[model samples]
Target: MDSSDLAYDVFSRQCSSRSTLEHVTGRWGALTLGALHDGTFRFNELRRRVDGVSEKMLSQTLHALERDGLVLRDAQPTNPPRVDYQLTALGREIAERLLALIHFVEGRQGEVLKAQERYDAARGGL
Candidate 1:
């Protein structure tokens, strides 16, 4: 049919789901999505908000997100080469879902901690 219809079909496929899930749920992906949930940020700003991520890791993660049509990269010609990043419409939707996922994980942290403690004791790692 048309581009819009083609896009819908692709999005409806199982493969698309798997691909998007992999990008959005990876260790760095989750953090990056969460960081962008607030608003647009420069490259260095994103790195700072993402906690322990390194420059290389951040670069790789951003590239993956950009390739998947989740994040937008804006490079401006400036004295120091300013680069800014923000979520696309698709990215914003994904970020919202990621925010809920973050809430879910945080809510379960206590239970998870207890389970980890029990497992550690059983395994003699405690």
Candidate 2:
């Protein structure tokens, strides 16, 4: 397909970009991408780094990212097979942007918590 024929509107239900956006922005996707940004990692290492992610979810996330061409999975034919995941060039680009957002959120976490407290108090919620 021609580049100009591509759908740029993510708001449209039929837009393919929506699926890509979903994969990139999903909870597992975000965390997985963020962790991979540091360097390539084995499955268990990724699990530890992501924290609270289940093996099934991690596997699913990795597969999806790989399918999206954001992650490259390399399997070595060692006696005890070893598989490592690293971000592709495209993955690195998107991961950098996502990491920036993550850093911003981390930096503003205190303010965000305070805002949430105020919002909850207004709604009579703890």
Q: Rate the local accuracy (lDDT) of all candidates.
A: 0.89, 0.96
Best by lDDT: 2
lDDT (Cα, tens digit) per residue for candidate 1, span 1-126: 764565433355554656767789999998998899899999889999999999999999999999999999999999889999999999999899889989999999999999999999999987
For candidate 2, write residues 1-126 as lDDT tens digits.
997777599999988788989999999999999999999999999999999999999999999999999999999999899999999999999999999999999999999999999999999996
Candidate number achieving the greatest TM-score relative to the actual structure? 2
lDDT of 1 at 10: 35
For each candidate in turn, the TM-score is: 0.83, 0.94
Instruction: Specify the poorest-scoring 10-residue window by lDDT in model 2.
Output: 3-12
- Alpha-carbon lDDT of model 2: 0.96
